[model samples]
Target chain A: MIQISRLPYYGRQMLNWGVTIASVIVCALILPSRLPGMELLGIGPNWLLIWVVAWSVKRSVLQGAIAGLALGLIQDGMTSLHPSHTLSLMCVGILTASLKKQRYVQEDFISVALIVFGMTVVAETVLALQFSLVGDRSLAEIWTDHQQIALSSAILSSLWAPILYYPLNLWWEKMNWIENNA
Target chain B: MDTLRRWWDRNWLQVALIGLVISTAWVARQTQGGSLFEVYQLLTRPFQSNPSKQELLTNAKVVEMEAKLQQVEKENQKLRELLGYVAKNQQQAIAAPIVGRGADHWWQQITLGRGSNDGIKEDFVVTAPGGLVGRVSSVTAHTSRVMLISDPSSRVGVMINRSRFMGVMRGKSGNKAVMQFFERVPDVRRGDVVTTSSASELFPSGLPVGRVESVNLSQSPAPEAVIALSAPTSVLEWVAVYPVEKNTDSETSQANSK
Candidate 1:
């Protein structure tokens, strides 16, 4: 039989994995919903971006990029495929992971929100760049629209990021603590 | 060999988990998230509006309109018969509740609670009480996604009912749209009713779209008019799906020639 000490460690690892995956599922489910007060200018919070930020804040760049890629693909399925969202989301994940916030900013909701806000802007800019390159939409119109969308998305996503990030982070942190103690 | 084994032992679980997740997400994307939408449809089934109550109350009103419509249709049919014209039959429509909005803001779309099970299909025209809403772009087993008329990429051939001026309507990100006239000096004015023209291949003629809000006749290569969409797109609760004639333009041209 497995030793009692190792049992808790394995259990905690499993629990952490479960929580992480559950959060991703929640984000995917919420993508299509436009519940009251969840909208601004016909836009909703970037749930996938928030998930990426949460995942990357405590992980490595490769892990963050992978999370972004996975979530981006799901989002593309929910939306349209062209001008792929994978690039923008992967950039967000990589940038957030490379921030190494634990060194400069404390591990807290405020910091997480700040990171998400910046990352949202970055992601939107990446998308705008792609749109500009595609040349389907006029540059002036694209940039003007980008300005409005980026500001609104960033503000809303940052404010709402903690609502998802807190519980998820708490669960992950608890599981990590349990594993370490075990 | 020992170093390689150590590396594999340390990273194998993580690699496997990542691979599993990436592949699952990829599969979901490839299938256009049909499974996800099916689950969404199931979860939202209870909340789907029951037509029984509303239908009963609206039955009298609808019957009165139907009677008037029948009278007009009969007159039209008689006129067509006199002219030896082959009258086209109207397709049946299915009513569905608006379950959700677009997954992302960039694309203007809506999720309807009805799908293949209810005979909904891609390219079906969707309209609400006020006017034309959109067209079904994709469908899953029990739910369908609609591309709203207000999407930037969606262009429809429209005409002013009063002046018979023809133009193409393009979405302007919200309830408003911009209509570009084919004629430089087209007769158009504010408050003119816009409808799908017979020239449109995607949509059937005479479906109300919106009313012109303003006109900018001198604005470049094409005269532009801003239109206020008839349907309250942001607050749409329910919509009706009509099976569109796949080649409506060709059929109309054939009728005209005959």
Candidate 2:
């Protein structure tokens, strides 16, 4: 463990990726848990969504989409399959990566929080659309339920975005700095 | 040829990584994150309160209620025997602690600490203090996921105990449910007790669900009654899971609790 930092550049890169993977695993495990201060009206922060946003905010469009797809599938594994989370999360990834292209949103915590807020509502809306399209439930019921889900999810996810973003952003920036200097 | 080789050198690793990630995710989605739940169970084991220990900590009032319930259950069993009806299952109730809740707000589910290792299977009914809570949706070796009745997607066949009026009850958010009556006008009162009907294939019949909170007539498709669930849905700490099996014989009762 002491020699880890002195390893070759490739080993360091591998370590960085390993850390990234571990972070995803941590988020997945906590998705089902409603730990204290992490819960709101029986809803916890959308951890996977947070992970996706953090990943996509600085990556390329393709990288963002891939992260979204993978995390969305994992979320589906945690919850129900119908109206799969894939489409919404993939869309979130693409939009977020593109949102960076315009430079309209700054890279501050407040802007990140705002982005998470908008993205969560979009993700939930896509899910509600799929539910309505399935025709198993009534339209009125789906929309009303959508309203509750979107608001709570948006509020909770936005508030918790910084907790995840800070560390991940720090590591990614460090890795970028290393790669650039080397 | 030079350009092609250059492109391959530049992008092969990224493409391979993406392929690997996508396939793993697909598998995870299909398998319902079995390994993740296992890890979660392992991590949460130290934190979860022991069910047996919780039972021992029960107050005098609950012990009294249990005694009363056992007496009524005995009477019901005897009455069914007298009527020449055979019971369906002889499975024991597995006590489980609620370890986690739904991954998101859209799905109303809770993860249980007990699973197949504890004899819990899919479709087993879960109940809390007051009445029916939900059904077991998925299970890993040591953890089971329950799809709650309060989810909008969940539909249960329920009846008014007072008038025997039947209806299909669909879950609304919170502790409320809307029961759509088969009859145009159902004879339901505000305080009428509701129970699972015999027609429901998923759940055992006659299990208590909730009490009628309001009766709504002149609705679009059919008259509906709003029920306030007796079981504590939002704040469930421990729940009892009863194993259910398909009934081959013409047995009326489900739990053959001998």
The candidates' interface RMSDs, in order, read 1.1, 1.1
Question: What's the CA error at residue A132 for candidate 2, in Å?
Answer: 1.7
Computed on C-alphas against the true complex, the DockQ of each candidate is 0.71, 0.83
Candidate with top lDDT is 2
lDDT of candidate 1 over B1-258, digit per residue (tens): 999999999888778888888999898888888888888878877877777755665567778998999999899899988998866776788999888888877778999998999999889999987789999999998899999998877899999999888999988777888899999999988889999987888998898999999999888989999999999978767889999885556776788999
**Candidate 2 stretches greater than 4 Å from native:** A1-6, A105-107, B87-89, B245-258
Q: Best by DockQ, which number?
A: 2
Give the range of the ten consecutive residues with the poorest summed lDDT in model 1 chain B. Answer: B51-60
TM-score of chain A taken by itself, candidate 2: 0.93
Docking class of 1: medium
Fraction of the reference Cα-Cα interface contacts (below 8 Å) that each candidate reproduces? 0.69, 0.90
Cα miss at B209, model 2 (Å)?
0.5
